[model samples]
Structures are given as C-alpha cells and as structure tokens.
Target: MSASVRAVIFDVGETLLDDSTFWGSWADWLGVPRHTLAVLVGVVTTQGRDNAEALRLIKPGFDLVAERAARERAGHGESITDADLYPDARPTLGALRDAGFWVGIAGNQTERAGLLLRALELPVDAIATSDEWNVAKPDSRFFERLCTWSGHRADQIVYVGDHRDNDIIAAHSAGLHTAHIRRGPWGYQNADDPKLRATATWRINELTELPALLISSDTG
Candidate 1:
C-alpha cells in the first residue's frame, strides 16, 4: 500500500451494514414478528444469486417493501432513524475519520440506502450511488467516479468491500489498493474467489482490523 493513502473509500451494503437487518427491519415495521420477518429477506434472497446479483434483481421490491414497512411503523421515511446499524460500523467509520483519513462511501446502492445512511447519522466525505451511475460494483466506473469526486488518485486511495469480484478485482483493475471485507458465505467458501487469488493484497475479518494491514501489507 502507498504511504500516500490519503483517502479510504468504502463499500456500503455488507461492508457498512449487515443488509439482513435492513431487510429484517422492513418485515418488523410491517407488523410481522421479527423471527417470521426473517423469511421476507430469505424468500427474496434465496434465489441462488449472490447478494450482488440479488440486489439488482430485487432492489425494486426491496424499496417498495421498505417504504411500506416504514410507513406502517412511523408514517414516513423518517422512521429509518429506528433502523439497526451494522455492528461496529459506526465505530469503525468514526474511528477512521478521526484518524485523519478522508472517509467516504464508494458503493452500489439504491437511492433509499442513502436515506438510511442519513438516518444512522454516519459521516462521510463523499457518497456515490449506483442508481445515479447505472454501473454497479465489479465495474470500475464506481471507483472512477469516486476518484474524480474526491480528487484522489487511484494509488492514493484504498477501497474496502466484501465481494471478491466487485470489491477486490474491480478496484485492483482500476489500480487502487483493494481490501476485502470477508463476511459473506460466498467469500469464505469460495477460496478461489478472484479477490483472494488475485495478486498479493490484504484481507481482513472486519473494518477495525485495517490499520494493521496498512502497516504490514509490505512486510514480506
């Protein structure tokens, strides 16, 4: 990693949020019991596509249900204030920002997800959304936009995300330092994930583990 790493651009969905809880919140606000509501996401996400693919296919339905759920619970989108934040996300993000890093989100998400970030009160230097770009992760367009917006060169920014294909491979192709947030079943099971098997890079179990990687990335 370059010592010139002045900015850290992050992926949203699984990186900053569990995404499942967001789905669960939808069902809960709809008056479904929390446990039963889990099925709501299960039903939609179980179609065999990974979260990335499922997102593109199910986003419209996800948004419709989310609006319905929020309206049922609190009468408007403002009710997202009560949604769950992924465990440790607030702390990790806040810590990075506090550590003199330029913190921002370079993610593929529906417009509604931006609303969710505001509800959570997360601070970011910049936010890029796929709805606006029409290009999703694993495509370098998202990263390219981020560099243009942040005015940071690719070599000076680190992109952290979950999917091997979307996060690691794509960013690597763009010449940014890529880090994989190893959370999902697909990543762990797919040892041959393009990210893990890609040229030497750092992988971590969680966001808070980043500083060590920054220091040790070139130890070899």
Candidate 2:
C-alpha cells in the first residue's frame, strides 16, 4: 500500500493456514507419538536445523511417500481442507482483494496445494508452490518466479509469512517488503532472533492486522 506495493503474496503454511492440527494428525497417522514428534520438531527448529533433517535423524528410514500412502490407505491422508485455514484468513484475503490489491499464495508446498485452495474457494488471484515452480523459498529463483507470476516488480510485492529464515529474511533479501506474523512453530521459535526480527518490514500479531497496516501505509 506504499503506492508501490501492487501485490501481497503470502506463505501458505502458518501464514494463511494453521498447520498444527494437520501435523498432529500426520504424526498420529505415522504411528509416532505426538509428544515425540513435537520434541523432535522443537529441538531441530530451536537449533535452526531443517525439519526434514530432524525427521531423518529420528526415523532413520523415514519415507514421506510411503507414509503418505499409508495414511491415505487409513483414509485420512487427503490434502488440507478449509478447516485448516485460520479464522482470520478468509476475511483478510477477501478484504484485500476487495481493496483492489493482487493477492497470491506462494510457498513451499506440494503441487496439489493449488487444487486444495481452489476447492476451499479462497479469494486469491494466483497460487504457486515449490513443487509447481521446482524451486522453494530462500532461493532467489523462487522469488523471481513469484515476481513474474504476480506481474509486479520485487519491491511492488509484500511477502507475509511466519518463518524467519524462509519468509522474512529470504523475501527481504529478494527485495520484497516482508511482514512477519507471530504464530506457528517457526514464528515462536524464531521470535528471539534479533537479526530475523530486524529484517522484517512489519511485524504483525495476526492476519487481521494486515488490512489496516496496508491502509495506514497508503494514507500515511
């Protein structure tokens, strides 16, 4: 809303969707105790290590594909649905679009994310994923592709996310304004990181703050 920001692209997980329940269910489906999974996630996240690496360390032979298939066979491995969206998500997105801003969802996700979001009927103009783009966040190529998809310059876009490294620092490095939302595991874990907090253009408590922040930016 700086007159230069024409689009606002959001990270899917933790940004628009509350993934704690999804991951809890997945842990149950994987036959691992929820507390155990939580401990592993916390340890790795606190150490600033990749979650995938933590999975490998814990399970030793973890196969995501097979685990997913097993869950589907158990009849609960379907993609996330509307219920996974945060309470503020739909209203915030709708309000943004109604205000004439281009809204998009772009983040690390499977190719099916687009299909799932569309099924849920979110008011987004574009949706892209790491699987679809063959690139992921913190990677310059991913930001480049996102810029192209938004049809806006890097500075004309504001990337909102919860992850300090993957969202705030990465997007800022790519020349996009960044909004760090304080929710989700990564958000809480990285909350004390001075560098990460310093890079964010704005720090928000929830999605509901976005509309007013943009509006104020425009008027100010």
Residue 134 in model 2: lDDT: 90
lDDT (tens digit, per residue) of candidate 1 on 1-220: 3367767888877777666666555555555666564443344344535443433343445465456555656754423342355576777777777776787886777666666665566866777678767777777777788788788898878888776667777888888887777675434544355536673266777788876566444522
Q: List the residue pairs that clash in candidate 1.
A: none
CA lDDT, candidate 2, residue 102: 96
| Model 1: per-residue Cα lDDT at residue 161 | 77
Best of the candidates, TM-score: 2
- Per-candidate TM equals 0.72, 0.92
Please give the range of 10 consecutive residues that has the lowest summed lDDT in model 1: 51-60
Candidate 2, lDDT over the whole model:
0.84
Residue 115, model 1: Cα distance from true site in angstroms: 2.3
User: For each candidate, C-alpha RMSD in Å?
Assistant: 4.7, 2.0
Clash tally for model 2: 0
User: Model 1 compared with the native: what TM-score?
Assistant: 0.72
Tens-digit per-residue lDDT, 1-220, candidate 2: 5567778899988889987776687677667887888788888888889876656665679887777677778888657787899999999999888888999998998776767877887898978889888999889889999989999999888999999988999898999988899998899777768987788888888898998788668521
